[model samples]
Target: MKNIFSPIEQIDNLDAKVIAGIERLATLFKSSLQDTAKRYKLTPLQAQLLIFIAEHSTKLCSVTMLAKEFSVTKATASDSLKTLVNKSYIEKVYNPDDARAFSFVIVDIAKPMVNELTHFGLLMSSSLSSLNENELIQLCHLNLKMLNIFSQSGLITCRMCYSCQYYQQKNGGFYCHLMKKELPAKALRLDCPEHLKSS
Candidate 1:
């Protein structure tokens, strides 16, 4: 296996260097998450669960769904949910659509913390401040391309609109081919359960 964090100079190809940089950035971001989790007296998985529930819509916030989204087993998802519930960070409620099912809701006490965690990327914002708007857009495209490659390799899966086969762009607007409806750019989901990998 290739060492993703090897020194950029040692890499002969520019693309390889860029991939290494992305890996390095991800490492640093995860380190930040670990630090934040430590301060809040929660495990990293617990912190991630809080963020996931906070970001997802109520209908999509169930333990079974989370297990699938996070690629973890049902028992692992239940354990993490249990920890969050015990800490009063989230609560399970009966699913309105299915009486037999339940979903999670972030508690009021956790709202502010969840908001803070959402902006944790700000820790590395300064490093990207030098990039202009066009550069940022280009970087975004490159990152998406790399994400697709990783997904193909079974290294990771992203449920973002751009990664879903349902995603479509038409007449300067976005649409969901699967849903057969026009979708607003702002409404694009980051953790959609309906996501199907683009071919």
Candidate 2:
């Protein structure tokens, strides 16, 4: 029972199987990122950090935040970021409140590579493309529920709608107060720049 990888017939609990499947999916994502990193001559974490900077707001790309996000030490995050700066993939912007602190923005020259890097998730996306609309909706809703739980527990950091002040659940449906609209399960965002933590 403790081993999720025990033969499927030996494990009766659905949760273990589900976790095992998710771990496999995570492995695929890591493999794709690793391959991309090798091609770009960058470390896996550095490549991931570059992609993260390209997609997220610069304010969220600081060394401190990046370290927490990736579960790495500040020194490791800072070293990777320094490598990124040396490679000219990103430029630093000083914090207006504290000149000693800074964040990063992807450089123009790295846009093409960043665009390619963003496709690292395409394999996962494509695998799910075969699901019907309702199935996709159900999957999205369940995944969001789990993600929200993980975020709430401080196991991870996320800017998801489920954790945002604007998000609401009413009569078994979701709404976004900031957007002034009901949110269809498929429309829910895994990460939103406009996210404001719920008080």
Candidate 3:
């Protein structure tokens, strides 16, 4: 087979190389998830839905929320959720606040599999072992910056506090400009309900 990234090397630009690297990394990550999902007789989408519901708070696990989070149509999210429910990987419960909406929760049978999937870092950690702690931190910061850019461009959506327009830093202290309050570093949310796209 031809090398898909070979043309990237011939581009003679750092941006091209960086974009190609990100694309290649995403492909590899998807392949890893596909392999793992196959072992459990689930599609990658189903596995992703299971993991998302397991990680997020109950209030955020509705089908509409899943559709928004995954950038998929509501019908697609509903189909995936139905499959997970059929497999006993997740169950839907009536939402107290919304009569028409239901919230999802991972079933007990799926907890162990979800836990195993959450260790995905272990698969890639060895490859990053050569980097020093400072280098790792720098890489993380760069990745987060890229994520913010992608989110702002509408190429992606991220609910991380760092990606929100309200997130601000002054004098080495974090704050939510929208809420007009300081936030502890440890309290920054990974999936915030009020996340707004940063300009």
Name the candidate that leads on TM-score.
2
Residue-level lDDT of model 3, residues 1-199, one tens digit each, is: 2343678463676676787789989898888888888888888788888888988787678888788778888999999899889888899899787788789999998899997775665878888999987787668767767786877777666787787889988779779988899986556665687877576
lDDT, ranked from best to worst: 2, 3, 1
State model 1's lDDT: 0.78
Which ranges in model 1 have alpha carbons more than 4 Å from their true place? Answer: 1-9, 13-16, 152-155, 163-166, 169-199
Best by lDDT: 2
Worst 10 residues of 2 by lDDT: 1-10
Cα lDDT tens digits for candidate 1, 13-40 = 6766776776777788788888888878
Clashing pairs in 2: none
Q: CA shift at 89, candidate 1, in angstroms?
A: 0.9
Give the Å error, residue 165, model 3: 6.4
Q: What residue pairs are clashing in model 1? A: none
Error of 3 at 94 (Å): 1.3
Give lDDT per model, in order: 0.78, 0.88, 0.81
